[model samples]
Target: MKFGEISESEYNEFEKNHPLGIFLQTVNQYHVLNERNWDAKLVALRNDNNQIIAAAVLGSRKLHIGRLYEVTGGPVMNYNDQAVVKTFADEMAKFCRQHGGLILRWIPNLHQAKFDDHGNVLETMNQAAKNNLELAEFQYNEPQKVENGHYSKVALSYEFIKRLNGLNAATLEKSYSKDAQYSVKKAKEFGVTIRKIPYAELEEFHKYTTATAERRGFKDKPLDYYQKSFKAFKDDDKFLFAELDLKQYVILQENEVKTLADRRQQLVEKSEQHLSKHRAAQARELEDQIQHHKKRIVRANKLITRFGQKPVLAGSMFSVQPQEITYLFSFMNDEFRDFFGPYLIQDYMMKLAVERHIPQYNFYGVAGDFSGQDGVLRFKQSFIGNTYEVLGTYTRVVKPITYRFVRLLKRIIGH
Candidate 1:
């Protein structure tokens, strides 16, 4: 096999069709990182017939010492092949060394295990691929760090994914948890509409995401990152927003209030005439419903006064790849939590996936805490998906002396 740099078109063509292909391994992501001042290159290993067998987008950034090189999301290839793994690792190490890299970091898009929503191991997958990488001199970083709430900014070590095979829009809702179904129904009833927004509207998406990041104690990327991503990915990227029509919601609530009041009035009259406990109870329930609708109407009116007739309740960004549709980032207006806009967004995207014949729906990252206590895991579980634990980040030191010296310096300087 010959190892060398490949053109963007060649890398993209192979990546889009590879079984392990992910958006992170694509040319689009390379450009996204390259524009941010990272030295990004598309490298591939070609077989005797000159067919690309293994490919990766290597990104390097200058550090305090030498350079930190990364192969995020891939080097997409048949990981089960020991020869390919060894060759790729050797070539990557050589490439990194020549480029003055201290360490070469790689996060393969290979799953180590599959689990149920509650973290119960259902199956062990791709163990050979992991062994091959380890045998090739890549040191596996313990996944426990990510499971313990320390997440990597480069890539996710754990993910929540839903299989969409043999499922359509009509059958998809049946797969959701009862609560998720109820939320979707309620969001629809409240006139929450989901639609794809253009690149010009990313600021609106970023606004909510930034607010959510602050509220949830996480960092968010700048608006330019999203803009560049949209430009690079183009049609493959979707920026969806869930908006509530305040006027329609208010009208619906007002009508419901009147309807409930009329029912309560009739029940009251019947109770007076029959003097029955059942009729009295029915009237009480009707009265409660009427009051609830009235409160909803009042709240809707207040929202309209503040945010106008239509307001965005939630926003999410998704990536459409050949293998799956990924739910990458999302945010919601906390005040509109009752509207369940996030649920609606998920349902909409899942149906879109079904329509497009996408095989999987990736609910990107989760702290591998499947104890039902992790909020991210719990929320994703509602969509009825399995947990996938991938072999976490791996590091190969290209320049050991420099790496050790840098580490020592950093430790001494309290960096």
Candidate 2:
């Protein structure tokens, strides 16, 4: 087998069809990181026929001591093959050492275990993959307990994924929880429409995403980061906005109010003519519905006054790849929570996944806390998917002396 840097085109071709391909391991990601001043390379190992079998997009930046090399989300290859795994590890170590790398870190896109929504382990997997990497001299970095709980710097260890294999539209819709189905229906009933937006509209997406990040206490990337990503990924990236037309919603509400009032009038007339208690009760129920619709109209008008006639209630970004469709970043206006726009966005993306024949829809990055206290997990659970705990980060020290020196210096400095 031959190991060395390969052209972007060559790497992309191999990665596009690989079973383990992910957007993070693509040339587009390399370009995205390269633009940020990271040294990025597309490296591949090929068999005697010069057919590429294993590949990785390695990115490195100079740390205080030496270069910190990382391969986020992969080196797209079969980890079960020990020969390929060992050879790839050896080559990567040599390459990192030659490039003055202190530590080489990677988070393979391989599942460690599968858990149900309630965090019950349904199946244990990837032990052999871990063992193979260990034999290849890569030290597994087990998830560490931090103040916030289990955390890993390599990548998100837990993900909620819906497997779409052999699922038709009927079965796919059946997979969702009742709440999810109701939310999607409510979104449509509220006149919430979802559409794919262009890169020029990313500023709008950034605005709501930033607000949501602030409200949720998580850091958000700058506008330029998303812009750069969009530029690089182009057609493979989807920026979706779920919008509501306030004028239309208000009109609908007004119509409903009138219809309810007309029905209430009929019931009241009937109650007066027959002195029927049931008719009186029905009239009262209709009156309550009329009042609710009137309130909705007033709220819609207020929203219209604040935002424009049409306002985006939710926005989400997705990474489309052959292997899966990943729901990446998303945010929604809390004030418009009743619109259920985010639910519609998820439904739209999942439908796209099914249409494209993608095998999985990944609702990426949950806190791995399934105690029903985690809001993110709860939201993802509504989609009826399993929790996947991936084998976390692994490291192979390319320069042990420099690594040790850097660790000692950091300790001395209380870093």
Candidate 3:
């Protein structure tokens, strides 16, 4: 197996073709990391057929001790194929040895590795056993949780194939949990309107997103971040967080949705008695079927409410990808929140996903270990999608002393 660095485009292509592509391996994440995290490299491993079978997208930086090589949600490989995975690991080890105390951290693309308390992480202890490389203690933790190396990546999923099918407003309202359904109902009275702000409306998108971030104690991305992201993802409008003029459009849609859901529920209860009654074996199946019908009704109603809002709203960027729609950012006035503007906007977004065929919506990194009492996690869990735990941070230390000294200094500095 031959290993060498490749370009971002090549890795991105590989990422798309590879079934195990995680968000961090995507071109978007790579570029973001390279721009902000560290210097980067693409380690490509090819088979005799010259097919690139195993690849890792990593970022490296020179440290006082030696160097730091951190893989960003990568090392896309066939873990079942021991030879190839070993080759990849050996090469990584060589890089570490060459750099002196190499820290090769990774977030693997598959469910192959075993992690203890902190979800999937690059296990320093088991590296040798799994890939025939020597080991070190695994230190997998984030800024807030890494007291003695604790980390977690929040990734959620639903019964993807079945649950996300309510691909539009009709399906979304149908699939929502009762509280979620109630949240939908609550949004309307507040006069919330959910709609994509289009690429042209990025300024506005950043507004809501920044507000959301600041509230959560995260530094919001600069305006340029969204601008660059939009330029790169113009084709995928589904990922963008849309704006809802609460008094203008979102509330109206929610009200209309609330009305439709009520009607459908009434129909469903009435049909419950007349419909399939194979009471025991067919219970779940029948419930799903009834829910699907009601959802279709709600969707039809949302369509009717949107007709009057052509020139009524502004613009925003959108990501059309089906399974994962991440709102890069959003912003809104806290003053207007009395309308529960955010929920109104969220309801509209779920409806949009249903309508546009985007199933999985990502609210991104929710302190997976429950680091603190963050209300946002609750908000995200209230949606149609279930929470997922992503592979946590992995680093193969190139310069152990450098890390050690840094650790010492951090400790001394009261970090």
Candidate 4:
């Protein structure tokens, strides 16, 4: 097989149908990177028959020591085929060298590693890493640091493969954790609704996302970042939100509480007349429900008074892809988390994907440590699906001194 730079149209046509395809490997993504000041390219490997077997979209940046070329969630190839991986790596090294680049940095979309909670390696995820290092004559040195070797990259993606043929809200509910199921039901009962917002309404999504970042003590991308993302994906992208009508919810809860109170009174009268075991149990359950509704009424009243009659934007999700939808970024107004906004938004996205005939919905980017304590992991795992531990990132050093100097510079820059 030989490697060659392919046109954007050719690469995208191949990528659109590949099972391993992702937004990161799209020509649109290259455009986004280019806007971010990175030089981008689409390269492919062809078999002896001149058919493309693997492809990648790379973005390069000039550093003080040399140019750094990075490919995110690529090259789109079969990592299980060692020969293909090596051939691609050697070709990639030459490509970088030709471009005056010192290294090829990438996190391939290959699932080769699995690990236990304590970080014990269950499978040797070394072939791709070895291929990358050997092609550039670099060593996988100690601690897996950027200075020694590229640090191990881990991301948790919740992937659902089942066709949405027989799926509906209730059936999907059965797959969720009991708490999550209960939360979904409660959110519905409390009148939380999910809606798709057009590009013009993306500012609201950004508002909630930025608020979340501030609350969580993380840096947030500028509004232009989301604007570029929307443009990158074009019509394939969606910005959705779970919203609560605070005033309406308050009224609904008030009426529900009144109805439950009446039911509790009726049950009390029945207990007074019969006092049977079933009657007493019914009375107790009615009382519990009455209390629950009353509490809900109070909560709703508080929210209404605080946020007013407008629909409260509770949480938002940004999704993109042609056949498979991936939730690229999401955030909730943490104060409204009790309304289970995030849960409702996720379920809404799944239903939307299904309605669009998209076969899969991805909850992207969870740490692969699988320690059960990771809140993100736990939340995603609650929805019964597969967790893929993709082959982590690799760096092929094309120029040794330049690579070392770049690593040192990265350290100095606190990368």
Against the reference, the lDDT scores of all candidates come to 0.89, 0.89, 0.54, 0.72
Tell me each candidate's RMSD, in Å, in order.
2.1, 1.7, 11.2, 4.7
Please give, for residues 210-310, the per-residue lDDT of candidate 1 as tens digits: 98888877788899999999999998899999998899888898899888888878777766677477777888788888888888889889988898998
Q: lDDT tens digits, residues 1-415, model 4?
A: 9999998888998898787788889998888888878899899999999989989998899876678888788778776676787788788889899889987776666655554434555665546555654554544322232211112332322222223456665576786779778887888987888877777877877887788777765556677778887888787677777888887887887787788778878777766677688877887887788788788778767777777765555655555565577776778766687888778877777767766667767776555545566676567666655555555556667888876776788899998
**lDDT, model 2:** 0.89
Clashes of each: 0, 0, 56, 1
Of the pair 1 and 2, which is ahead by lDDT? 2
> Distance from true position, residue 238, model 2, in Å?
1.0
Error of 4 at 295 (Å): 3.6
Between which residue pairs do clashes occur in model 2? none
Candidate 3 per-residue lDDT, tens place, 104-207, comes to: 66655433232222234433223333342223333554433522212223222111111355355455666766777776686564334555445676676666
lDDT at 271 for candidate 2?
66
Each candidate's TM vs. the true structure?
Answer: 0.94, 0.96, 0.61, 0.81
Ranking by lDDT: 2, 1, 4, 3
What does the lDDT come to for candidate 1? 0.89
Ranking by TM-score: 2, 1, 4, 3
* Candidate 2 residue runs with Cα over 4 Å from true position: 144-152, 269-272
Q: Which candidate, 2 or 3, would have the higher TM-score against the true structure?
A: 2
